[model samples]
Target: MRIEKEYRIFEDIEEVRIFNATKKDFYKPTPKEFDVEDMPFQELLNNVSTEIHSFIPYENGKDFIIQRLGTFTLNKYNSKPKDAMGRRLSKISPLFFDILHEYFLEVYESHTPKKIRFVYYNGKKLTKLSTAKIVFDMDRIFVVTNNVDTATNRRVDADYRTFDEDKTNMMENFSQTGSYYKVHGKYVWSQGVYNIINRAKEDSDDFYNIVFDLVIPEDQHIVDKIFYLTNNETSQCGEVIRIRTANGVMKVIEVNIYSYFDDSGIIIRQGLINDITQRSDYGLSKPVDFLMDGFKNSKKLALLIEPLSKKQYEFSKGFYYMIEKDYGDYNHSRKIMKNIVEKDVVKNLNKLINGELDKIDEVLTFKVDGNSNNKKIVELYIERFNYNNEVHSLGFLTDVTEDIEKQDKLVASNEQKVVLIKEIHHRVKNNLQVLNSFLNLEKRAYKNDPDLIIEHMQTRLTSLALLHEKTYGTKDFVNINLKDYLVDHDMKTEGFMELPSQVEFETIVDEDLNLSIEVITPLLLIIDELTMNAIKHAFPDNTATDNKITKQITKLNEGDARLIIKDNGVGIPDSKSISKNLGCEIIKSLTSQLGGKISLIECEKGTAYELIFPIRMDHTIN
Candidate 1:
C-alpha cells in the first residue's frame, strides 16, 4: 500500500491580554484618559490595548486584525512619546502627559516605576522616530549599538530601516571601548527604569561572583599607572629595571612600561632591554689607591723625560711609546722623527745597531773646528739606541778609531819600504850588468891570455850579473827563484868555457822554488867556480869529455834548499890542491855565509860539488 505524507506549519500563538484592576472591566478608554494620575500600570496597559483593538479597522469579520493591533500597542505610561500611529494606540492623545501620569503614580503608590517610558526610535535615523516600540519588562541596563544584519538577511524589510553611518560608527567604537548591553530586549525609546536597574544588577552580580573572568579593566588600570610615571620624565625613561636575582647578582629585566606621547597624540610604548647591565651596587666609597699610584708614576716618568732637549725627549718618548696603551700616538711620533732625522745618520746608526757594521774603537782624525791647539785628537763617542740588548759601544768606537789610524800609518810605511827595495834591486842589477860589460870588454882586450884564464873571468862576471838580474825581476826583491838563477848561470857557460868543452853541463832544479837574493848571489857564484874547476881539471884527459856535468838546485823544504853541482871532469885533484885556489877559497867563504856546506866527490861521472843549505826566503832585515 502507498502512503501519502502531510506537512503542518506551526506558528507561535501566545495570547496576550491586558486586565484593568481599578475598573474591574475591560473598557475602551479615550486617548484623553491616558493622562489620568493614580492609575495602576495594568489599568493603563489595558486602556491602551482596548483602544487599539476597537479603533483598528476590521475586514470580513476578522478579529485577527484587532488582536494584532492590540498586541503591537505600546503602553503610553511606560513608553517614550512616539509618532501618530504610536500616539493613537496609547489610549491618550498627549503622550507627554502620560509621563506626568507615570511619575505621579510612582509617588502615590510609594514605589519606584517597574517599567519606564523611553523614546527609542526603532528605525535607524538619528533624529527621526520612524517606528516606536515599548519594552514590556526591563530595568536600568546599558544599551550599546552593534553591527546589524545586512538587507540580504531575512531580518530587515523593504522599508530600508538602517543605522546612520556616523551614528553606527560611533556606536561601534563606544561598544569596543567598554562592555555594555541593554537590560531588556528593547529599543532605546521603549526602555524602562526597571530594565536599567536589572541590567546594572546583572553586571554587578557577574563581577562579584566571577571576578577572575574580568581581566581587561584591571590590566588597563595597571597600564595607566605605569604610563603616568613614564610620562612625567622624572627619571631616564625606558631604562631597564634591574634587581638582585636569585644568583645574588644584578640582572636587567625586559619589562616595558614606558610610553611616549608623540606630537600627533599617538602613544608609542617601547621595550627597555640592553646588552650591558647598569651598575646599581656601590661597593667602595673612595677611588682605588693603586690607581692614584699609577697616575703619580706616569707623571714622574713624564717629568724625568721633560728635562731632556726636545730631540732627546722625543727619543725617550719613542722608547716609552713602545709600551704605551695607545700605540697610534706612538706611531705618529715615530713617523715625525723618521721624516725629520738626517738619512745618513739614520743609516749609519741602523748599520751599527743591526750589527751589520762594526763600531769604531778609537778616535777619528777629523780636523776640529775653532780649536787653538790644532790637536788631532780622535772623536769616538757613540750615538746610543737600542736593538737587541744594551751595550757600551762607546769603547768600540774609541778603540777602532785609534786602531784604524795606526793601520793607515803602518800601510804608508810599508809602501815606502817596498819602493826603496825595488829601487835598490834595480840599481844593483844595472851596476852588475855594467860590471859584466866592463869585464867582457877587458877580457877582449887580453886576447893573448890563456883560454882558461879568460874563461874563468867571464864565468865570475856572469855569476855576479845573474844575481842582480834575478833580484830585479823578482816579486819580492828579498827572494829570487833559485831555479832561474841556476839556469841563467849554466846558459852563460857556452860563451865562457872553451871546447871540446869537456864539461857537459846539466841542471836539475825546483820549478817552484824561491830563495833570498842574498843566498842566491852567494850560491850562484859558488856553483860557477866549482863547475869551472871541474871542466878545466876534472877532465884532464878526453876520457871525461864524453860525460855530462849535472847541477841540481832544489828546495829541501819550506825553509831550506840545496845547490849541487857535479861533473864527469876528473875528481878534485886533491882537497888541499883546490883549497889553494882563490876561486875555491872564495866559494867556501860564500858557502859559509849561506849556513851551508860544500862536498867534492870523485865519482865515475867525474867530480861533483853538492851544497846543502837553509833558504831564508821570508826573512826581513827591517
Candidate 2:
C-alpha cells in the first residue's frame, strides 16, 4: 500500500474598520486577537496560509488596502508589506482591477454578502485559483478568501480554454449580432444561454415553450421543423423564421441547428440564431423571389449601401437601365453620382452614406448623356437602417422627368397668367385716367351745355369700351392688331353715331402691324376726335354733297410709321383758326403723347392731317 499525505487548505479572514473622520479616509485592520504594536501581524498573516488573502476596497473602487496577506499572495505577486499595503490595485494588475471594480462597487453599495471566483497567473503559468467572500456589518467589512481544490482548478482551466476556442470559432463563422445556445433532453437549455429569446435566464430554460410562445403563427412550420430536428438527431438544418417580440414588434431570424449526443447518452442540440430582420432576403425562397420580382417590375431603382464605407452593396436592374449600362460593376454607381447636377444633393447623399443623416427625401436632377443630351429628374428617397450591427442605407430612385416637366409647364403657365392680369390692370388704370382727363376737358369745353358734355363723355367712353372689348375677347391681351382694331372701331362708331348719307368712310391699314395697348389707346382716341371733327365741320349741311373720308396707316420703315386722315370736304376756313378748335388742339396733344409730330397737308379738296410716329421692332408680325 502507498502512503498518501493529506493536504489541508487554509482560509484567511480579515476585519477592517472604515474611518471617515480623517481628512483622507482610509480602512485599517482591526485584529481582535493581537495588540496593534506587537507580535508582527504581517509575519503572522504570512505564516497562516499560502493560498488566501484579504483586502478592503478603497473609495475609488479600483484600488484597495491589504488588511492581511497570506503566503500564496506574497509568493505569487512577490509583494512586500511596505510596497503592497494601501496601494493602488492597478499598479499590480490594471486589467484585473478594471474587471473587479464593478463587483467591488456592488458589494460596497449593497452592504451584502457576495462571492467571486477568479484565476491568478504569474507570467505565463497559472499560480492560484481562489474564491473571495465579502460581508459588511457595523461600519466594518469582513473578507474571507480560500484556495480552490486542485481538481476544481484544473477543470476551470480546461473550461476556460475550451470557451476561448469556441468563442473564436463562433466569431469566425457566424454573425456577431447572433447568439448561440445548447439544449439537452426535452427543451432543457444550457446555463450559458442567457438573455436570448425570452430575455431572462430562468425563462430561457424551456426552449420549446419560449419558441412556441414567441414564434408567429404563420411561421409555425419552422417551429415544427425545429422540433423534428431536435427529436430525430438531425446533423444540421437552417431556416429563416419570424417571431413577435414582447413589445409587439415582428422580428425575422435565421436559425441554424446541429444535433449530437452528450457523454451521458442524452441528446444535445446546438442552435445559432441570427437576427436578419433588416436583410432583404435569406435565400431563393418565395419571399425572396417575390421581392426580386417586385424590384424587377418597379420603375424605381432600389439599392443598398454600407453607410460607413459609402459603397453600393446591391442594386436593382432599373439602376443599370437608368445608367444605360448592360451590367453593374463597382464603379458604375459612382459614375451615376458624378452625373448629379446639384452640389447640395451630392452633399446630402454623402450625409446619408456616412450615417450623418437618418433619411433623405428629395428630387435630384442629373445631366444624362444620351441621344438628346436631355436632363433627367429623379425623386431620391433614402432611409437608414441597421444590418449585422452596422449602419446601412436603403434607397430608391424614381425617374420623374416627365412629371417634373409637367410641373414646370404648369408653373410657367401660372406666371404668364399673373403677367397678363397685371397688364390688364395697368390698361384698365390707364383707360380710367383717360376717361378722367376727358371729363375734365368736356367740363371745361362745354360747361354751359351739360347735355353736350355728357354726349362727349359717352362717345369717348364708347371708344375706350370698344378697345377693351376687343382686347378681352382675344388671347393676346398686351398687343392688338392695328388693322383689326381699326375695322372694329369703325363698325362700333357706326352703331353710336349718325353721319351724312353722302359721306363715306374708308380705312387702309398695314396688315402686319400690331400695337400695344399703350399706343392703341391714345391713337384710337385721336382718331375719334379727328373723325368727329371731320364729319361735323368739314361736311356741313350746306357744304358739298359728294364727300369721302380716307384713313390710311402705312409702315414707312423699320423705325417709323405714318397715319394720314384726309377728307374730301371744305378745307379749314383759315389756317390760323386751326389752333382755336378744341379738336385740333386735342389732336396735337395726343400726337405729342404718341411721341410723334403732326402736320396739316395741302390737299386739293380736303383738310388732311398726317402723323408720323416711331414703331417698336417687336410690334411687327414679320
Candidate 3:
C-alpha cells in the first residue's frame, strides 16, 4: 500500500518535503525477509539470550534509512508506526545522526562491527537524560539499541551518597562561630566572616580592603601588621582590636593571622576572626606583641650592613639557606651581594651608603648561584638608620617572581584583547566599503528602478547583518560555523522573498566546517545573491509541485572547500545570459574576493553552481 509522508533532513535546517511511495521504497537495499537469525543480535552472538529494549535494522546506503523498527524501539522513542516504519535515522534522532553516520561509514568500508554508548535527551527542555547503547552487526548493518539509563543512574547515586557522607563528616569538624579566610596576593576566599562583621554584604567589597576600613583609626598597629606580613617576616600573629560595623556599632574582635609558604614559593596568609564583643575582659588595653622570632625561620632574606665601614654585615639564616651555605660561610656582604643582586642595584646601594640617596626601593631581576640556579625577582628596600652610634642599613628582600610573572601575563592578555578589537574594527570598515560600492553601482545601473535597487540592497545588507549576528552569538570572534551561517542566511532570504510555504529549501552542510569572517562575509553574499536569484527567476509560474532548493558545503581533500547551490526549477536557458546579469557579476566578484573559482554544474532539473575556494588557515585578512 502507498502512503504519503513528510520528513525533515539536516540538523541545522528543517527542510521538509512531502512524497508518496510504497513502504518498501523507503529502504534503499530493501529489507531482507524477517528471520529469527536475521535479527541484529543473532548475527553478533551464536545464541540469543539477552533482552533487547530497542532493535532497529538500518539499511546502509547513500542515506541511512531505517528498514524497520521493533515494537520495543518504537515504544522507547515514543514514535508512531508511520514515523518509524519508513524514515531516515536522522529524523528519529537528529542529535545522534552524526555519530551513527560515522559508524555506518566505518562498517561499510571495513566490514567490522562497532559498538557505541550515547546519552539522549527526549524532551524539549532536555530535562531527561537516557543512556542508550548501539551495537553494529558485521554481516548486517542493523543496530541493537538498549536503554541503560536505570543501570547508569544506580552508579551515579552511589557516587553522590559517598560524597554526601564525606561532606557531613567535614562539616562536623569545622568551627561554626569563627570565620576563616585565606589571602594569596589579591585573591581572597572567605567563609563570610567579613560580611557578618560589616553587618551588610557587598558584592564589590574586597576582603583586605574591608578589614582595613573596619579597624578603628586609633589602632595604628594594623599598619605594622601589614608590613610584617607583606615582607614575610612573621609566620603568625594575634591581636585584639575594636572595629566599627556598618551600623555605626563598635565591636571588639580577636584576629589571628598565619602565614605559610605554598608549594610554588608564594606566601599565603590565612586568618580567623572571632567576635568577642560580649566579653567583659577583652584585653583592649594590652599591646599586640608581633612574632619577631619568626624572622630566623621565615623565607625572606634580611641584611644588616654598616654603610660607613662596608665591612661589618649580618645576614639572616634565610639568606644562608638560599645561597646553599651555612652560618658564617659567607662573611663579606659585598662579595655575596655582588654575586646575587644586579650591578645596578649594587650601585644604588653604594649611593645609599655614601649619602647620595636617602633610600633605595626597587624590584630587580637576578639569578642566584644555588642548587637550582633559578632566576629570582625580588623587591629590595634599603634605608640608613642610626644604631649604636653607627650608620647602618636595614634592608629586606622579598621574592616576587611569581607575582611579577602573573602581572606580565595579565598585561599580555590585555594587549591581545586590543589586537582583537582592532581586527573587528577593520572588518567593520571593510564591510562598509563594500556596501558603499554596491550603493554606487545601484545608483548608476538601476536609477530608474528604485524598488529593484532597494530590494537588492536590502538583501545584501541582510546578508552582512546575518553574518555578524552569527559571529557574535558564538564565543569565537574570528571564525563562525559555516553550516549555522548558511542556515541563517537561508531563513533571511526566505523572509525577503516572503515565500515561506511555496519553496522547499534545504541545507546539507558539513557540521564541522568553520570559515573565517573574511571569507564568510563575501561567501555569504554570493550565496544570498544566487539563492535569491533562483527564487525570483527560477519559478516564474510558482505552480511547480516539486519546487526545491538545496545548499550544501563540504570539505574537500588537500585543504580545499566546496559549496554547491542547486534548485529543481527550470534550468538556465543560455550560458551567455549570466555574463550580462548584474547579480552574476556580483557573484563573480565575490567569488574572486575569496580566492575561489566558480563554475556552472550540469544538472538534469535546474541550475547548479559549484564554488571551489582555498580555505584560509591563518584566520587573517590580507
- Maximum-TM-score candidate: 2
Top-down TM-score ranking:
2, 3, 1
Report the lDDT tens digits of candidate 1 across residue range 1-622: 1111111111011111111222212223443312212212534644442222222212211211111123233342333222222223224433323332333333234433222222222221111111112222121111111212121213222122122323222222211111111111111111111121112222122111111122234244543444345445422233333334222443332233333433553333322222122222434121122322333333112111211122322122222322333423443222322421245544654565556655522233322232334323333333333211222122211113345668898997798678768667665775477446535654565457656556667787777766655665453556576666676777777666674535466788888887766666666667767776666576667643366778877778887777767766546546777676656766777788678888765566566667888877334444
- Model 1 residue 438 CA deviation (Å) reads 15
For residue 61, model 3's alpha carbon misses the true position, in angstroms, by: 99
**Which residue segments of model 2 deviate by more than 4 Å?**
1-331, 370-373, 388-392, 401-423, 448-452, 473-477, 542-546, 617-622
**Model 1 segments more than 4 A misplaced:** 1-454, 499-503, 540-546, 556-560, 573-575, 617-620
Candidate 2 TM-score, C-alpha based: 0.51
CA lDDT of 542 in candidate 2? 52
Give the 10-residue window scoring lowest on summed lDDT in candidate 3.
7-16
CA lDDT of each prediction against the hidden true structure: 0.40, 0.60, 0.58
Model 3 scores a C-alpha lDDT of 0.58
**Candidate 3 regions off by >4 Å?**
1-289, 293-343, 346-359, 366-376, 389-392, 398-425, 443-449, 470-477, 557-559, 617-622
Candidate 3, residues 283-354: lDDT per residue as tens digits? 432111122234567565644333234454444566565555677556554555555556788788778867
Q: Give one digit per residue, the lDDT tens place, for model 2 in 499-530.
A: 76678779999998877766777788888888
On a 0 to 100 scale, what is the lDDT of residue 522 in model 3? Answer: 84
Model 3 TM-score is 0.44
RMSD of every candidate to native, in Å, equals: 34.3, 17.9, 46.2
